[model samples]
Target: MALKITWRNILPGCFKAKSPTSPLEPRNQVSKTNSLQRLSLSDISNNGSFFSASDISNSLIGFGSNLHIFTLKELEMITQNFSSTNYLGEGGFGPVHKGFIDDKIRRGLEAQPVAVKLLDLDGSQGHKEWLAEVIFLGQLRHPHLVKLIGYCCEDEHRLLVYEYMARGNLENQLFRRYSITLPWLTRLKVAIGAAKGLAFLHGEEKPVIYRDFKASNILLDSDYTAKLSDFGLAKDGPEGDDTHVTTRVMGTRGYAAPEYIMTGHLTSKSDVYSFGVVLLELLTGRRTMDKNRPSREQSLVEWGRPLLKDPQKLDRIMDPRLEGQYSMEGARKAAVLAYQCLSHHPKSRPTMSNVVKALEPLLDLNDILAGSFIYMAPTEGKKDNDDVDIIGNEHEETEAEKNEHRNVSEEEEAEKKEHGRHQHRKGYRHKHRMRSFRSRAVYSDTALYRTYRTSFDNPKLQGQDIVN
Candidate 1:
């Protein structure tokens, strides 16, 4: 009898029965003999014929990939015919599903789970974006960039297999309703990691412009390490003497740089601007744009930019969710870096390398401010006062939001949360006030620390879950 496969057993990575490989023929002679060619995004953008998925196997191979060819039947078998049970989430490309591969499938193929992204025929992105992802990820390999294990092109179907990121993306973690605020040091660690990923891309022999840089595109692993994923909009940096690559203006609404939006002149600085927006999001615990918010406060960059430059206004814009437990000096340094990154003048912006430098030191500044961030749970008759501060409309979680924290423990567990909390109670402005993030109120030094830990970890493990 054929065994049934599902999401639960899919974890820890396994393999199903093997099938024949795809029939798409390699048109060009893939030369592993030559040095792996770093793809030029500009070159690919200009040549329409070069973007053909069926015709690019040889080139991808030349760029450095054995190019494991998987047939549609193999993917379907592992994912249980792309059943809803195994579905991860949807992005611009299409719906992704979790799958597994092991030695049973192919010898020497490590036993591991993978995230498979299949292109939606009628989706916003098409073969071009899919092709771009193949070229960039195929050749470029880095610690912080998501690994493209293999891909499938059978007839009209296009699917990409990536190393499964257990924690999912940064967007959901940061913006999810009622979600415990990410610890200040964890936030800093993520920033540094993401910066390193971008630095590796920009610092390439011929720089690559990561046109699509946003919170959603930054996927987190079990360690909360941020890896830049989805290179559909990536472009190869311009050659010698070319100041910038002029291309169609493309990126998420609030994250795109002003100059790139107006003139279509793309540069590494454009990514820096987008990075700044994400950094601000991390710093203030806000979205890049929220239509639901007030008209004046809709654009987080505009509202937060002014506040970032003014140190006195730091607390006003700092994620109130932090509750005065964050590093004051570190926050100040991060704000200045964010301000510099958000500069209107592209030249004024620092390179990704410089951004990495600015963020690395902040991770070491874990000295918690000597104050208490007391959050009293919302009661129906509660009034806004010195004690009852409302945070971003008191996030109301829908069924979808409630189920969002799955597979995220690794990020929290490996984040050294216990050590961070141990420091939280070491110094407090108020020693005897305890508050339940849920529906209760008490005050004590020990209980306050316990409450803080309890509220942050919803379904995630606590106390025993911390990494040693």
Candidate 2:
């Protein structure tokens, strides 16, 4: 009989291997690359050939036939011998370079652009991370998930190939100076796309916890459609009666769920918490942690959570660059959702599905206008406009009426100022310089592309970071 093999059998100690024996004992740190290497040796033994290309190709779990296994020579040619001119950006993994592949190397595939990410042998991430990305992205496919085109694993060199995201990541768009400000509607749309990706991961047959759900990991394509990338820290969720998976804490500091950070308990809710932080960034255009900012304002959650519920303070917390283009009702509802996700108790947070539902209506322009009109409807035939005295005479409208009038005027004035600012900004484009954040280095080429292409595509799609 032919020897039967399954993913579990091929990789006996996979992600779902076993829980730590003791709460206090450190979890096993065996690198995934080592495990796969051993498995490759076993495959060679079974096939009676060392380093047989066909056998090696068929040995990878779930990825054997589906993904293209590129040779080091092939990638070298695609990236023009790893020229610096093609450099994209660097992350924990290593420096990424832009590349192109034609029908010659990939039969039936069209000539297209791609981002090639080479693993830094001495970087913080290692072979295990490179493998983790392939395993997770190889199996998971969604519109909002970044596409993993292929990978290169020959000798000591490890690399990944991905679809080129023209727009890049949310981090650069939201915080990078001189970047095109994402309008309220575009921001809402991006949020919904990202939330759907997370929801799909959380609601999978075997739930996946996206341990890293920060702005840097949320990429955008040419149309400003957000997609989640960098699955190095992704983990399988709990099984059966288990409530949570216990693993060593690993994630960006400000974006990590407090419960996960405190106790090493991983759950779908932990990803929800991180999503909330990104949502806040979209709303406020502020970094989660900025040492350059005032000490009290550095932690975005701690400082912004209380203000989310206060309508009067909403303007103060919102991104000034937005210039009052958003609907008040939509802002309020989004703020409420963010508040729930950032709750101190893990259970208090909404699931990614619910988060998606809550955001959908917020993007409806008609609904926002309708809700605003109803909220501002005149009572007792005191017309809505009667509250404001244009003659500059002090007539005591009710406190509510005065507040409403002030808010309207503020929004109108903001719009006018924003228009004027845009006109003035056009003249300074040539002198623009990208300011880098200490948290993540900005690649010069990527910045140049963002600046040059700001007016090329739909204005809404221009800003953000692209990953390899």
Candidate 3:
């Protein structure tokens, strides 16, 4: 007599041997159970043959125990039968729906909302991509990385559940015309948070290279805190002295590193370069690739890199929507840091750790401005002084003093320009004469320290908060 092996005994919670149909059950729920029955080993096996216990154990090991194996019916119920009202947004994988899971569905878990992403059968990516997301996000956890709540792998259906991000993505915030422009401080905070996420991934025992790092993949919270999302395209970094992992070139076009695009070799530096592109977007409020822009300015990196070294030209590239709210010194330093990250050679770029250190100080500049800014009332009939405020070391000046200062500064600037032109003409005949352009090297540690000291050491203003 052939020994019978029940699926209930083998897979326990994963499978039910003889599920009785209930009149109260929804039609879709009944179909889902019927689908599970078809995948049972008894139907596939010849004459109900029993399998060795070791075979069952090996198969179960691949399924992560830490992840909750959500049934298709459960997800459907939570998403209100995938109602149109619950639809969030569509991506390459599929459309995401907002869902709420209570303790009734998942015992011991708190009641909270989640974003369920159902895999599109005819989409560009399939089972392999789904499996990659489950295997990576299920294991990696960080404050700056979006949390993976659970996943469903029933029959032909595949879905992922993640913590709902309140503010959507960086791409929407940065590009949407109706959205309020993110304040300079908010942009810096987002960049630092994102860099920390990438740094975490790179510093892992077995490093992970975030092959896809674009503004769209960076999700923001209510407070404008940024979190990294979408692990489908992530790959393990090269191990043990290996420089890079050779793979098919894949990533958003404008953000892919120059070397990574030229060669299939991928490294952690590829992610660093992509971060720089997004940082540029945050700084300048420009898209990586925009056909609407002038032909020469279509590619942001190519058009912006040269301007980063020149403070006078850098202001021209800044986002006009910012309305001169950002500190000039801080913006110049950030531009220099971005230029370094976009270096032609990967090795020349700083590690994510160093990138974090560089950005931390920039945040203090905003904090100081926020805490120390004062709104002074304008004198009657003094329309010119109506909108003026003392910033940094400058004190309020009388109209006469202001005019005199402006005249002197204008005269000095004209003299310098005339002197520069004369020197250029004199050097026209000298073959080896070189004109020095300011670069990242100009941002010395001493200068940065002095800037930080001046901002942070200022006494807080005693009045109503004015700067918004």
Candidate 4:
């Protein structure tokens, strides 16, 4: 049934955005490195991946992708000829403009706001990147990954359309100057959502490694639900006996895995290391590399990693923007997880699924802690101890919460002894991370190849075909 699409419905309430091409400062467009000195031109552009626009157009039907094929003229009309008022912001990819789509506009595309990304032909990324996004986001769907609605590939022009994320990227939300700081619970929630997205990729049938997992690529919806974006640098993970994918070292400088930068050994663990960096950014409210800070404090991982393990040192590194809002336990656990994920040894990092398990328990901690007065800072003379004077309230934690925390502590201690070398000292497997916010296991670590999936059907559009 085709719903009536009125002009009023086309420009929704949020569509009245004011602009002269720039509203908020655009998110930082970090430079992506080309392959090493030995690689040829084809290798640097990831031509080996066979993701040409024409190639995708011919094979997309077989890939089972149901994405709409939009014409350039259709997009121009929706975006008001790429008007300045409709312009959202720019990134490394290209300038994005706000647009609307409905069944009236394209038959199968739902009536909703969208962001149209016009590929900058002369810019850093090109058709290969565009095709990668169309293929990856085309076939793979998850709650945490952004929805790629459709695309236009016409006469040397390439564009991608995605669901408009209200709050924009995590980089703008977390690091934008003069913006409201992200609360502790909200940060944890975003972390969990982003981690789930990565977990879904790594847990897929042919495991995907999101080559670029940085703050700017994680967008938030109106509800603040984090969704992974930008599949430009994404690649399939190694299979069978293969341990790692050797590819061009292409990723933003600060977020790329050290081992990958050193040897081009791309693995799911590389993404984990990047996640750890973002987690650290969330905890500290700082960029991975901030030259604005003192020379000693510029590199977040360098200055912050040492403080994560020591509960006493944890507060010194926490985001001062939080204003003593996070519980000591919650903060410490997050730091420890960040520490483990930032492990120099790839094998020492926990999987994304495990990262999700660890983050889930933290969701409820802040609410209970704040309301029950369980997370108050120690008063003068009680500086060394964490025992908080209880407030008279029904918000107090039940005995079960205490027992659960105790059990988690015991398990952590046992795992501590299993530490192998310097790298393994911080690493632990999946079992220890999930100790239950609600005391329920929600993920499967044994899912070798995406056995653990929540079904989602991409809407099939029959209106147009790709212009090859």
Query: Each candidate: what lDDT?
Result: 0.71, 0.69, 0.69, 0.69
Off by over 4 Å in 4: 1-64, 366-468
**Cα lDDT of model 2 by residue, 1-468, tens digit:** 222223332222222433323422111112223224323211212231112222223444333325676777899999998898887677777888888988788786668888888999987678667767876786677899998888877667888989888776777766767655776777888899999999998987667888889887888787779999888878878768999998888888788888888889889999999999999998898888877889899899988999998876776687776545466778888999999999989999999999999999886644222101112334456665564332224334566666666776677577667666342121121111111110112223233345546542211212122121
Between prediction 2 and prediction 4, the one with superior TM-score is 2
What is candidate 3's TM-score against the reference?
0.68
TM per prediction: 0.73, 0.69, 0.68, 0.67
Candidate with the greatest TM-score versus the true structure: 1
Return the lDDT, model 4, position 247. 89
lDDT of 3 by residue, 207-233 (tens): 889888988888877666899987877
lDDT of 4 at 391: 26
lDDT by residue (190-227, candidate 1, tens digit) is 89899999999898887888988888888887667899
Q: In terms of lDDT, which candidate is stronger, 1 or 3?
A: 1
Of the two candidates 1 and 3, the one with more favorable TM-score, higher being better, is 1
Q: Give one digit per residue, the lDDT tens place, for model 4 in 143-195.
A: 99999888887767889999988777788777766534676777888999999
Best by lDDT: 1
**Residue 312's C-alpha lDDT in candidate 1?**
71
Report how far residue 7 has shifted in candidate 4, in Å: 37
